[model samples]
Target: MIIADNETAIDYLYYETVAKTVVKLIRQKSKEPLTIGLHGDWGAGKSSTLLMIESAFKGQTDTLCVRFNGWLFEGYDDAKSVLIETIVAALLKERSGIAKVADKAWDVLKAVNWMKAARTAGSLAFTMATGIPGPDLIQGIGSIASKVISDPKAYLTGDVFNKVMDGAAEHFKEAAPSETTPQRMHAFREDFEELLERAKVDRLIVLIDDLDRCLPQTAIATLEAIRLFLFVPNAAFVIAADEGMIEYAVRNHFPDLPAATGPTSYARNYLEKLIQVPFRMPSLGASETLVYLTLLLYLASGVSDSSVEFKSLLEVARKALQRPWLGTGFDRDKIKARLGSIPSDLDAALQLAAEITPILTEGAHGNPRQIKRFVNTMALRVEIASERGFQDDIKQSVLAKLMLAERFAPELFNAIARDASADGSKTISILERKVTSKGGKDADDDPMADWPNIEWVKRWAAITPPLNGIDLRPYVFVSRDRRTSAGIGVAGGPVEAMIERLATSTLGITQVTKAEAAALTPEDANRVFQGLVTKIDQTEDLGKRPPAAEGLARLCGDRPELREPLVAFLGRLPVSKIGGWVVSGWGVAVEGPQAQEFAELVGEWATQTSNKPLSVVASLQLNPKSKRK
Candidate 1:
């Protein structure tokens, strides 16, 4: 299922209640401007709540709602200037006839540009009107004069220098009449209020979202901009961010605060000064999560949330949830009536929601986006498997149940996968017998009685969509966790068994099956090395070529006695894999005598063919340390 990872069209979390409260607060006819902080952690639906507040002013002519996402315009030199320009432009766009307001807004932009130029010219700009150059200014002038005289053709009469001088002169002249920073900010406020009056807006609500995602500088700049609007009448600012993150930004931006008044104190004081009112979005509960998952699944199944019938059904669910005793259980018949015949996928999603809600709620820490992400990840896995003609034999619930174990009970799940890898049919037989056997004398005498200790494992084994008598290799393969790939159907043979042990074992330099590598005699090592070479040769994707070579390298790196075996392995390899390995840095793993022997083998092969590239790479790999010098 793929619901859009954005604000919900329906109020799944009842955040509209919070949004309404915010709208009511902003709508109040206060004499002074107000700042309300909508604080929540990342993905706690702060953006969605902001959207809901914007919706509250949809058709109202008296209230002008504007949203600014600080993260969208990040990396700018001055976030405060960007905010000032963007707000003025939006206001002018709303009412185009206000020429006086537009002119004043243009002056704000010009003043900001003048200040930027003044900063660039450095301390000399302070004495531009005194008609006497300071030492630094004289030094700058002398450097230019020397450059012009020393290289007249290269530097004299160059338009670039003249343009730079002209620009600096213009800024110096313009800045003499430019208003001070305080005077300009006051003027901006007056112009802003005039524009609001001209537009006939009773209240201006500015919703700033995603402030927490910005860096320290940008976050502080946005906060400072809000302080400018905090005193203007009939204006309100709602900033959505995590309070903790904002505090962290404050601490980082102002790092040199005195220890007695420290970063924490400054951060708290800054937050209090800016955000006078704070509202936090509560985390989702079990019932709420189930309903949310069901709705999301329904939407993903192509149901239109904006349809009158769907909205009515959603309202009914919301009303039922508000009742303490009735709970979140919706009337199935009513929903079915509105939706027509329920799609089987939707039906399954609803059922899966009921089964997985509690586990998902706990695992996700009551976060809605986390639950959505979990479902999206599962659906993508299933979709990809189906595309590859794999896992078509399994049901969705089986996948969900397996994922539950993988996500929440990781150790238990990995153990099950390993057990299946060691022996699939035998493991399945044992589990089936243990789960199905009646509690008689045989059950009491069962030797593996205490196995599978995790609560979720027991629950999984007992759930429907029975897994008895099935080879779990496909399920484990679909999981896509590389560590669990060992459990995915190993063909029985000494060579294959050796390969599995080598590939799955995490040890030695390459971290590949150390015990197996240590156990091999020269002859067995030769056979196993040939087996890895054969596997790499048969593999079509070159991406899968490195691990086998790495395993061989680690084997030889740890036990140099296997150098002769590595020679045989290298002699049999296709020149392409060798060249690819050498160029791709897999040669670095081949150390000691193994590196020398492998390089000699490649050198011999290169001589027998016309592959000059292989010859060059072989020489480099043989004397790899020469490149370091």
Candidate 2:
């Protein structure tokens, strides 16, 4: 069973404590206008924490809590107006029994409508009031309004402008004429304060989530809306977002700000000024990750999250999380002791969690969402193997071990797959011996001597139930079509488009393609590189240089940070299987300090006794003029 990836009010991961602390802070400062920044990375349970805080304020008559997701209103033309209208509408709905509260809400909506019309009509209304052209009349209006006023012919038509003005007149029928934007803002705030007083609400707590998912413009607009209530009494806002994304939005919204202003960046300064109290969500450690995974597996095995049994297990897990340094989690004895008896499925779950926790903790970087995703993926693979009638052959422990390599060390995983596919025996004797060997760390005499000297390889080999003589073809076949652990799927986008073009472009990558490759973010570039490597791994013949080979070389040339991974991939390739073309095709990608490493690799290839063809080719490259001069 797959775990749903949505936010819940459950106290998993011990986030309820953080939520309770935030709720207490809001209650203590309910009368004053307050803004608390609930900061975390994506999928770090920020939304779940928000739900917990809202749950804490349940059934409280004096304090009213409203939830607003900026991402939901991202498509609207004006986020600022949408946020204001949402709060007012919520207030009116809750206080419908009060006399004239609906009327006051209608007045606030009319004011919001006026603000909307003014944005469209631009400085025409303000220009008429001041009787001047240029920036002087556009002082109080925002930059967008000023642009419309500065050049009305470009942004506004005569008929559209008149319609906007007519709408404004209809909205403000009972109000005064020649009312400037600043005056309208002041009136809107005063009216909102009055509505809060009439509603008799002691505190208005607005919880905003998913601000990081919005575009730069929407994010900034929502922040601007929050600014309106900064001075109004009895209003508190809890905004949840990734601080880095918000800072990026700030930089995009104000591109002219200096990179370094005083001690911090200008973008950070803007966020600091808006969000008064900031709470950063901590990433899960190994022990906490173990507890989380164990609970999830229990849920997958039909243990209801709301049941008393689950709650008791949750308490045990939370206590274990408190002293994570002890490295103790929900072991088999603990589960049996609490539940009085362990289900057959839960026994398997405990074993899988114990086996996968070490690497998964480091691989997922202690993110709960990532850990859940890994567990879901493993469960799905196990189901697939069972569906294909090989359930007995593909044990959960063995599959978990293989998936750890697939998720963390992809290059090594690919090599193992290649070896399994090349020989019908479905076994790599060298790797089998490496994992089964019990000795000190000596790379010089290890069967995995050619593999990279990364700690992950050592840790993976040290895992229980080593693959000494298991027929891995079934496991490899089941996991063949899975996505890379980078979370990038086969979705069509700019990066995927580039990858497709580079993979099949027989004429070679063009200058436009090089520029495009150079423009990719480092993370996207790595994804593209990984995609290319996957393509190379699937190819039947390593003797010929596929178009993806050229693409890899060019990408490495564009992004030098990829050279090390490139070298590692080359080192893992079967020397006898690959062609001599691998000897020297990276024109400028291997230069500077990397050139020496390339030379050493070539020297090893030249002396290799396995493949004479590769050795001869590498030798020729080392001394090309020996035969001519």
Best by TM-score: 2
TM-scores, one per candidate: 0.63, 0.73
Query: Model 2 segments beyond 4 Å from truth?
Result: 123-167, 171-178, 423-432, 435-453, 483-629
On lDDT, the candidate that comes out on top is 2
TM-score of 1: 0.63
Task: For candidate 1, give the lDDT of residue 162.
Answer: 41
Q: Which ten residues in a row have the lowest lDDT in candidate 1?
A: 122-131
User: How does each model score on lDDT?
Assistant: 0.62, 0.74
Once model 2 is optimally superposed onto the true structure by TM-score, how far is the C-alpha of residue 30 displaced, in angstroms? 1.0
For residues 121-166, could you state the per-residue lDDT of candidate 1 as single tens digits?
Answer: 3333322112244455443333433443355346524544443343
